[model samples]
Target: MSSNSPADPPVRRIDRVLAFMALGIAVLSVLCFFAIMISTAAGMQHADYATGVWPIVAVLPLVGLPIAFLLIVALLIMSIVRRGKAGRS
Candidate 1:
């Protein structure tokens, strides 16, 4: 039911690239967040809050990584919906 043939449209390529980029960012942020959490925990075990751990714990949790994950999910969902619509037409 679609006009597009075996080859994907150029727009699809751009979308794929963006999706991959988002995924990469999300993965990296998640890894970094876990590392920070572990470090924060270990730092707290010694009751030493002066090692700049609080800032990473406070700021990173409130921003950055969550935004990256949300962006990645949004991009992937959008891509899926668009691809479905394109295929149906």
Candidate 2:
């Protein structure tokens, strides 16, 4: 027997593509954050700075990560809402 339940709507190709993109972004961000944290920790332990560049370089990721996170979240939300609308149609 076959059913036509809303939960059983056929999956769209776009949704799968978007999901993979989001997953990639999440994985990249996690790695980026980990590297930043490790470098920051190392910089703190060995205070052998002459030009004060390490501190500024370390802060760059901390500042940019939040913005990237917000964008990724927005992308996921948009994809979900679009899929919901398509299902209703």
Best by lDDT: 1
Give the per-residue Cα lDDT of candidate 2 at 7: 58
- Candidate 1 lDDT over 1-89, as tens digits, reads 66666634346676767677667666766766777678777665544544665555445544666776777777778777877876787
The C-alpha local distance difference test score for the whole of candidate 1 amounts to 0.65
Candidate lDDT values, in order? 0.65, 0.63
Candidate 2, residue 66: lDDT: 67
Which pairs clash in model 1?
none
- Best candidate according to TM-score: 1
Model 1, poorest ten-residue lDDT window?
A: 45-54
TM-score, prediction 2: 0.47
What's the lDDT of the predicted structure labeled candidate 2?
A: 0.63
